[model samples]
Target: METFLSNLSLGFSVALGLQNLGLAFLGCLVGTLIGVLPGVGPVATIAMLLPITFSLDPTGSLIMLAGIYYGAQYGGSTTAILVNIPGEATSVVTAIDGHEMAKKGRAGAALAVAALGSFFAGSVATLVIAALGAPLTRVALMFGATEYFSLMIMGLVLAVVLAGGSVLKAVAMILVGILLSTVGTDLETGDERMTFGLIFLSDGIDFAVLAMGIFGVAEIMRNLAQPESRDVVRKPIGRLLPNREELRQSWAPVLRGTLMGSILGILPGNGAVLAPFASYAMEKKLAKDPSRFGKGAIEGVAGPESANNAGAQTSFIPLLTLGIPGNAVMALMVGAMTIQGIIPGPQVMTGNPSLFWGMIASMWVGNLMLLVINLPMVGLWVRLLKVPYRLMFPAILAFCCIGIYSINSLPTDVMLIGLFGLVGYLLIKCGFEPAPLLLGFVLGKLMEENMRRALILSRGSLSTFITEPISAGLLIVSAVLLVAAIIPNVRKGRDEMFVE
Candidate 1:
């Protein structure tokens, strides 16, 4: 307890400095702007801004980058709720019920719930990191190749539950995504498997291109095809805050999601990305009226938004405590720390206690700043709904094109975005969901790499995964989920829950 209190004091002393606070605010502001812009994610934003951070002190540089990371979470939710375009993978779940709420003239309510939930989650996660960071890092380090592979298998099973329609079609989409992931060159061998002789294809498909094409461009196409009166912005804008019933429905989900996210975020290899998806699936399963999901359910919005933010904050645990980068964003942070001549890991906590704790303390302040920024901006975001579709869609197209082109300065990527847009439209027409495909695409390479490593470590013995306790447990759970998915009664229940 003394250590905790002492660390807290040190953290506040440094984080509360005027210069640090200003940097935190700037990061939050810039992060929100990046989030609001379709296809511009924090990874790109941080990479772009990294050189500027070299001029600042280590503590302030980290504080600002941390602020930008979580601030993007808040900003992404705004776009998802208002325009059905998710700026980040974490915001994809929000777009489901959130955009539905917007169509019902409840855009204000959705945005408010997202922002409030994120703030609550961020606050709790910061505390969790402060208290349990070391222990969590130890647990993450214990996960070997076998355990990691099993855990990802379980995650993919959960992704199966994320489907709102035909289970077979969802599974097929995942398989397609796995196939797409194999398009790049073999990591171990220099041979290309599916690039079809195109040099750009050798690096595999860009995630931003896929997301923008499917969600942004395809959505614009769909909206244009619809009658003008069918647009949701034409409806009266509803109240900004949730009512008594909404508050009651969302409270428990928020708490549950925060707990889930805190635990998952500490895992290596982008485990935090799975938090919101897991939260959404859990809320739907636990709901008495599961059928209300994907139709503007308050629980859907509250649970996932909270989980996303919590995961974003807690993902720093591995990096700070073990010097392990959990995702690309953390990888950039590792580079930032290295450039600042600060070595990461347990030694840094002892050697530079102020820098360590100050960054942690800044997370709370940043979350507070995000809340202050987002709530007032709710009115401004809702006003965007009033724009005409004709003008709005072209702007979206321009943004998507610019965002894609900015990634590599390649026109081929722009051409690929259009191609994927057409593909997305076809999939939508066929009643298939693109969300599962995305999950599969993201996890496929990780799963393949880990599984291969596990096999090699065990001398090609298949039983290695089963012999490891943690790996066995995860795979068992995955098997159970698979069996449950195939059972007649469970399938019927799932089908009913997803019925539109």
Candidate 2:
């Protein structure tokens, strides 16, 4: 307890500094704007901004980035509530009831509830992160190469299980990602392996370039292709505050969602993506009038928004502690850290305590900033939504091109965005998600490195993986999970759950 308090105190000292506070505020502002722009998610925004962070201090830059992440959770609800356009995937459930509320002239109240609920969840999740950080890092520190390899295998298995749609497709995307990760020089031998005699290929694909292409440019393309009409609420937003009955109904669901989201967010395989959906399902099941769920039930909006925000904040745990990204957004964060010369892992806490805890503490502050910025600025956000998609698409594409080009002044990087943009579009068309591919790509190099080290230590003995207790246990669990996920009944149930 004493140590936790001491560390938290240290976090506040760093996060509350003038410069760091300003960065947090700026991040929140930018994050909210991007979130309001439908289809421009935090992944693309952060990828675009990575080059800018090169000049900033690591701690401040990370604090700002963390702010953007959770801030988007708050901002994503605005479009969902006012226009039925779900700015982020996490807001899809929010749109069910939120848009209904907007249609019924309760837009203001719904927006307020979402922002406040997100704030409460973010605050709670921050505390959870601080509490879990040291212990999780200690656990991570004990992992040897064999254990780490097995753990990563478990993570990929979890990814396959949790991934929506066909298991086979997800596995194929993951394999492709692993293959992409190998398209560079071998670390030990310093020999180019998969370069195909191209100089650009020799250095491997740039994470930011791939991310910008897959998410940024591709998102622009997808959004441009979609029908542009939106049923934006133009009437006077009713009272911004929830009524007594609404508040009364919301508090319990908010609490439940925060707890559920916090727990799920800690799980591997982008569990945060499941948080809002799970909360919605639970809320519907628990409601006396389940029929009200899709008809503007305040609890639906409040619960899922809270869950989304909480999950976004808590998903940082794996990235901070175990040096593994649980989702695509965190994978971008890993790229950011690597670009900044910080090798992520348990050592981050002991080696860069300020950066670690400060980022955690800044989340609470960022949430507060979002709450303050979102409510009064609701009018601005709604007005911004009136902008034409045609204008937005070109600007986004140009900005992405500029950002990609600036990375190394390589025209090849810009061209790669075009290539990957097509790839991303095809992935969507083929019913495969781009996120799992990105995660696999991020984890591939680490997995291969650890597997090699573990094999070397074992003198080419394949049984060593089973002989090590931790590795054996992890592999067993992973095998069980994979088998369960593949079972006909289990797979059907899983598919149904995600479909909801």
Question: How much does each candidate deviate from the true structure in C-alpha RMSD?
Answer: 7.7, 2.9
- Residues 87-135 of candidate 1 have per-residue lDDT tens digits of 6888999999998998888877888788889999999999998997646
Which residue pairs come into collision in candidate 2?
Answer: none
Candidate 2, residues 46-135, lDDT tens digits: the string is 977887777789999898888888778878899888888888889999999998888888998898889888999999999999999999
For each candidate in turn, the TM-score is: 0.63, 0.96
Clashes of each: 0, 0
- The lDDT, on a scale of 0 to 1, for candidate 1 is 0.80
- Quality of model 2 by C-alpha lDDT: 0.88
Colliding pairs, model 1: none
Model 1 stretches with alpha carbons more than 4 Å out: 1-118, 129-132, 226-363, 377-379, 488-500
In terms of lDDT, the best-performing candidate is 2
